[model samples]
Target: MDIYDEIEIEDFTFDPELKIFQHPCPCGDRFAITLDDLVDGEDIAVCPSCSLMVKVIFEPEDLEEFLED
Candidate 1:
């Protein structure tokens, strides 16, 4: 359970289809978090294959555009 790093939201690539934010993990997998997760006030992105997690830096208000249906 290692806390990897704190990364800016801008550093993540948002997938409109998946509606998630993605960043490449050093372990070859990806750190991902969904827009719902963000809207729910979550700030951590985790790698599905590993224990690495990163803190996401973003304002809840900043996620308005992504939350739109």
Candidate 2:
């Protein structure tokens, strides 16, 4: 699937409570993806209010710090 944009994981805001990464979407909503999804090798962050999606750029090892103990 073609994505609307390519964003680095560091550019996203990580919500500890929800355990999700979020970034602003042009459609006035946020593009979101969960840590579980990333850990499982998923990279697409989709906007809840639109069809737009952004590919999250990250390394598998970088996700280790976010893991629940």
Candidate 3:
């Protein structure tokens, strides 16, 4: 299954400065993504540390909300 297909964006936050979404990987791994790297409506990300490509479904906004709490 495609990453976008599995992902359901309940919330999201756009960070222009960072150029990436601060969110968790759909695989349950925490990671970050840049706007240039992301294709809208899709759940794909390149791991910074491992450089392993990942499919993400969680919205960045959800991560922000979690952080605020």
Q: Return the top candidate by TM-score.
A: 2
**Model 3, range 1-69, lDDT digits (tens) per residue?**
223333333333456656566555456654555554444545665545544454656655545543443
Candidate 1: segments with Cα more than 4 A from true spot: none
Error of 2 at 66 (Å): 1.2
Summarize candidate 2's per-residue lDDT along 1-69 as a digit string, tens digits. 879999999999989889999999998999999999999999999998989999999999888888853
Sorting all predicted structures by TM-score, with the top scorer first, yields: 2, 1, 3
Tens digits of per-residue lDDT, candidate 1, 35-63, equal: 98998888899999989999999997889
Please provide TM-scores, in order, for all candidate models, with all chains considered together: 0.89, 0.93, 0.36
lDDT (Cα atoms) of all candidates against the true structure: 0.91, 0.93, 0.50
- How big is the positional error of residue 15 in model 3, measured in Å on the Cα after superposition? 2.5
What is the TM-score of candidate 2? Answer: 0.93
Model 3 — which ten-residue stretch has the worst lDDT? 1-10
Task: Name the candidate, 1 or 2, with the larger TM-score value.
Answer: 2
List CA RMSD, all candidates.
1.3, 1.2, 7.3
